[model samples]
Target: MGRKHLEEITLLRGLAIIGVVAIHSHPPPLSLGFLGLNKLYIEELSKFSVPLFIFISGLVLTFRYTGETIVYTDFLKRRFEKILIPYLAWSGIYLLYRYLYKSETFSLFAIAKKFLIGSAYFHLYYVFLILQFYLLFPLFLRLIQRFKNRKTALLSIAAALNLIFIAFYESTLLIPERLPRRIFIFWIFYFILGAVIGGDLKNNKRSAADKISYKLLIPLFAASLIYLLAPAGLPLGSKLDVFWLMKKTFFYAALFILLSYKLASESNFPTHNIALKPITSLGKYSLGIYLAHLIILEPLSTIILNRNLLFILTLSIAWFFTKTVSNLPYGHLLVGKINNSDT
Candidate 1:
């Protein structure tokens, strides 16, 4: 199936990028007033950004490859040239930042090893996650080909795997250091969901239930909120409360589906609306912005002297900066794709 311009995905990506900024940017110091609630709400909203991005990656890949004959070597080659190149470039950028600006010292060999593991920067774990998915892609496609008609069953199995992994993570069974918490198994469901959705779209056999709506989401959101309303100070970890991850994974997937359904609709969505265009552009450049934002945030924190103002200013800078970088030669090697020539 040939790909169309899915602005809705870009819109979601744009939203997710901002949500990430919100997560990293310091919120206004919580107050005794409703400001406290506001902060918590922002945190809850931002929790889904990482998962949504992973989901989109799975969706795009599955959408592209489901029915077509896939060349495994070609796929990996494309992934390496397109994704790994930029990943390494940005990784080196962050390592240099740490060494020079932050005054952290480490051997070149150690830095190389850290890059492999995605410890170069706090946010680079995402690249590691995607690499995991890429490594597993051919296998995923083989399974899909074998179980060509068993999408729901495959999805169910993947969901079960995710839950079981969570249970193990939360159990007394020691999670090995090599298999870190951010491993692909922990978020397998999203990738599987994407494959199922993508294949379904290709087959043109979409399920009505999968077409989420506001009616389905509102009650689900309420239940999720209640389930996740733990005390603010509760120690959170995979071991402590796997339900936190469970709730976030389910709720955000549902919410994203609902939002995508809406934005993907015909009449109400002004795809070219002037006001919304910047956000869509931001979404297009999200990868670069994701990589480069930390560099700016570091300096901005000290000079700005105000958290809220600093957050907005840094995002504005990062957005334009990322856009500029993406336009230069070899930019796609850095930021994935430019999305459009106009972009």
Candidate 2:
């Protein structure tokens, strides 16, 4: 059976998924007067997609492992069975579609190699990275739980490692191929940070003050930093790597959780509102929406983005399709833990 329903958890999951979709949609510029400026803002904000998902996954993992000692092997197996397997399955399905529809040529041997090594394109990188994080989280968790004084030290190490990885890759240090050490370097920090925060929360009281510090100040600081530094036509190089982004994105994710909690606690953002209910409803099946929408967006962009009205119309159609598919049984297979019956 699932744990007690946390509206805050699901709502945040939904919000994070939509943030990801925004990244994918790469929506046309809003009329923010400065057209170029607005497009830049939307694009940068969309980059939060991966960071947001990682942050939430970290938070959830930490919450699960708190104070309870378990075998690392078992933990890894369970996580892989649930998340990695599904990712591989979906990746294969998408890969086949790409081969057939996009005229992307691939030998059978290459397909096997890409699948086994996770060297495919688009969001498959996240699938591979998450698996790496799951493998590393246990040892990382043990360290944080053992050495309470090492939080700042740990953060610095993560920062330094992030910088090293970025310098080499020109992107975040990812396992660009099937190299184990390189991949390990790329993803370990987020896993550790999540586990540390989870462990910390066990004794760390959440007073109003702590909430303000972590939830509000941290995100505001991150936003200010991004605004100051990230400008138009930025290539999102190593500076946007997992380690560097996590420091701020973790704050943003924490803020999202805190805000959602407070909002739910006070019934601030009510489902009673007619307009938001649809968005939230879509959010309910966000994983389904997420996994399926990419198949639509890539092709639609080639056609619809040429015209503003067509783009809007295409988005509406895509949203309708996503919502429809999410309502189906297959949708449950996408989000992992969510139960569609509740809706």
Candidate 3:
């Protein structure tokens, strides 16, 4: 039910990880120029990165664990141990970094509240989002197993539910802006659709329709690019919103992954081709870099480093730091995986 090792997925992960970093690598205050364009394009490419990550997680988890009898408690325990420990460690690290380096102060109780909500820093919300998905993995598995035959309907329902939530949440029913973000309703569609894709793969049911979807992707991608390139000064009355972009992002990621699968099959390129080795390695350590790269950015922001050069340096340092730390004793507690042994 699992995908045999595929090099293209790793390459996609490498792209996604760099996209993530690029979103954060804004240039220093100056006039708009090539550096500004760099930031804009990188941000556009990265808009789908988080959703892609979530989709990948759903796809891989469903592919690997669909038929296994899930002991919910034990499964959650094992999964959370790998993820929550690193989340908590990094949360605390960021909290201290804020207090010591920025000369900010907060009460212990305040910090605890911030930690619970993943509000200790900007990027930590993804941790909570992923953790919530893990907490509900058992339900997800059951849904996928039972509804694999009706995947289109299942995915359609999820999309409808998400859109309904967006419609209401964006209007004045007073659900409170922050509540929806912390809940899973906003993202269920992507995750469920990912499971559908994975389940189909597990069932060995590739069809010509898959190729049709790939062909359909080119126009969809162009439309998305046009939307991004459009002027941004419109008022809130404009119908285009983040949710619209999100819907497009879902399909963009979906079609891209399908195309990648098709291409991966066609290419006879060695998985460890010299050009791909570093990217695959970076993908392997994406988690640690995602957690720690903000620290690297703080100093870089103050200095006059070229944004492109800074990005490369940060990627290298983050990968090196993660690799070295993950080899040390108790490293798994801090970084989610051990590097000294075969994982």
Candidate 4:
């Protein structure tokens, strides 16, 4: 049997990529307090993009390959071909850009170090972090299967471990000097949650919209907003400060995943609605857009000062670039997989 394609997942990808661009395109500080607040809101809200992507990775991987006997070598080979190649390609491009425009000098040692650690660019660290998950996926899969009957307990343990790790890191600052935030421990909970959801969906074949209530969405949104903004006013060392911004980000990531599944359950979501074509297209070409956006944004930022306009331009240009490349030979290596089906 073929894998079922979920339009909602694609929609979530589209939304997440937009959020990613928004994070990178947030306006520079201005003298106005309102503008500062807007910047803070954008930055805070968009922080969920990376986590959402991570969640989607776990969900899709587990949903597709749960029962199958995966060969570790084959899996790693596929991932390296699809993801790592593009990462290297883009990392080299960014490095060259820095050398030419920013006048950054690098020795052979430095270049190798940058590639090893994903320090070639600010955003590329995510690729490094995700690669670690891919490497450890077999162990994670084994553990998940072993504890399949106790999923709730497993998830609770994962969540607790994540929070404990965050608290320890916050207190000791013991993150690896080379990798920094690229560590997998900081992100395991989202991946585990996604894997559990994927398993549930696969085994039950139920609509997520039916499982998750719509009424809870508004409350989640309100709570997320309040949590995000509250820290700005609350004094340091408050409860909110315990996890810092991570608490709110975790809340928002889960809420966004629920929202995506709910919307995807709609009958006319992407297929029947013409207005959603652009967004679905964004989802289709998300990897390419993601890899190429910062390249486009760097130059565009100088010319276009408006944050909203800059985001639009970066997204539009990156989408077009990805679309054009996806039609060429071996383009998938550069952009990850492209869903060629019409929206």
Candidate 5:
């Protein structure tokens, strides 16, 4: 039988996309003191968004195909169709936008370089990063299977390596300055953790309740809150510090995964409530929103003075565009797969 649909995962996706938008929407200046601190808090908390998405990718992929024989070619073809094609389309769109408005010149070689490196837009690097993971997933799967009995050890090792890489990346010691941030090693721990959890959920048929507990939740919540309220000088520097930002985000992402699972397991949790409809809908069209939002936000920023209003308008426009395009012939090639059942 097919695995049950995960409404909680969709809910988490909705939350993640909101976080993504929050990070991009520039808030008031730090001179505003309390208001600035509030905005900074939200933005800092949202740092978990990207890592959470990466974790979900690993989880959903493993959950669906753990014990099955995956035809590697077919897998690549599907992933290419769903992800890479849209990435290329968006790259071209962004390139044209820059050439027309920003007076940026692009030669054939430059365009090709942008496509290869995901430099067409700031957000496109994530697509490039995910594509890298997709390409190496088969090898990762085999490795996971080879040591299936020692998942905890595998996760521990991956986390240690990830932390070490982050430290090296920050110090610029062994890692080359030219090495791109899109490298998989920088983010592999979250994916591997997700894969291990996915495998357990599949092999053991464990309920969401079994995957989380109050003992876990209480401590994670305390840690996250403490991290949020603590002054910038304490270890994790200002938000501008990439190393500390990523380190904290990794912690937040793990906490979120557990929290989401716990919420989904509750008997009275209202997945179909009217208040939640928009969030779940946003989750449904998250990829399209991710691709389209920056394009909309850049143009709209000139007209919308209020940052909050700009955020809402950008999300609304992107959602409308995504929903409209998803119905057109071969729209997935432009925006991404929109069908809720596909996930």
Candidate 6:
């Protein structure tokens, strides 16, 4: 079979990038009035954003073949070259900024420690998690592909395991707090969703009836509604139960995957134009955009916390600058060399 064209993947990449941008554009729960509404918005949107990213990562890898048998050494080398190298370089850049200008003084060891811990910034946490996912992906893909004919069973198992992990294991492990990076337990499901969906899409034996079910729009709308209601539904009067919220979010992630797949499967989306040029470029240099946006977002958020005009202006200006620099010849190379080589 021929390799799938790269156009849709580019668009999906754009969606993933925009989701991240949108997530950071919204303020945290504590900062918003009618905390429940804004919190629901942030929690729901942000939940979909990173999982979409992880799903895209796995989807891309599952579809592309390098010809040679997958080897952990080569995998690690390429993964590190793509993700970690850029991360480390950018961490140094940010560290230097903090050292010279910000109130904080950065020691070399402190810089190294922060980089390793992924606590240097909010987005860097993703960098650290992707590194972990990259190392395990080959094995993960191998195991997932084994269930090609048993997809329903496989999905059931994944759902069950996810519930168990979320309810039972995560707190005991305290993985996110203790680890070098923030470990989002739900993202593992996203990664698997990407792998499984991509696998089914690639499989030849599946009939047209199967594809029709994939087209239903109900799941997307339902998931969005559930996500919106969760905070309001479980308020402190009624403290919004975190456990129940997470459980619903897991369902939300699945619906998101369905939505993403449906969107990607479409041939009608706009594929050209000037206004979209920046976003399309963002898709191409997403890793750079992902890492570089935070450099602007954090401070901008501080400066424009409650001012609506300033907030919109900040997001627009930052998006422009981020897209501009991400597309530059050497700028792309520098960050691309480290965090993403897929483009």
RMSD in Å for all candidates? 3.6, 5.8, 3.8, 3.5, 3.0, 4.2
Backbone clash numbers for all candidates listed: 0, 0, 0, 0, 0, 6
What is the TM-score of candidate 4?
A: 0.89
lDDT of each: 0.69, 0.55, 0.68, 0.76, 0.75, 0.61
Candidate 5 lDDT by residue in tens digits, 1-343: 4355556666667877888888777553454366666666766667778877887787777777788899999998988888888899999999999989899998999899999988899788889899888999888888778768877688889888887876666655455433546788888987887677667666765633355678978788679767654644333343233332355556666677667656754543445768788987888889999998999998898888777788788888998999899999999889899735224
Over 4 Å off, model 3: 1-7, 27-38, 168-179, 207-211, 231-270, 338-343
| Native-referenced Cα lDDT, model 4 | 0.76
TM-scores, in order shown?
A: 0.85, 0.71, 0.85, 0.89, 0.89, 0.79
Candidate 2 error regions (>4 Å):
1-7, 27-36, 167-184, 187-189, 207-230, 233-284, 306-335, 339-343
Best by lDDT: 4
Give the Cα error of residue 73 in candidate 1, in Å: 1.5
lDDT of 6: 0.61
Give me the displacement of residue 20 in model 6, in angstroms: 2.3
Tens-digit per-residue lDDT, 103-127, candidate 1: 9988879888878988888788888
Kindly indicate the candidate among 1 and 3 with the higher lDDT.
Answer: 1
Off by over 4 Å in 6: 31-36, 39-43, 66-68, 100-102, 106-109, 169-181, 184-186, 202-220, 233-245, 268-270, 273-279, 302-319, 326-329, 337-343
Find the 10 residues in a row with the least total lDDT in model 6.
236-245
| Cα error of candidate 1 at position 311, Å | 2.6
The positional error of residue 3 in candidate 2, measured at the CA in angstroms, is 11
Better of 3 and 4 by lDDT: 4
Error of 5 at 111 (Å): 1.2
State the lDDT at 107 in candidate 1.
89
Question: What's the distance in Å from true for residue 271, model 3?
Answer: 3.9
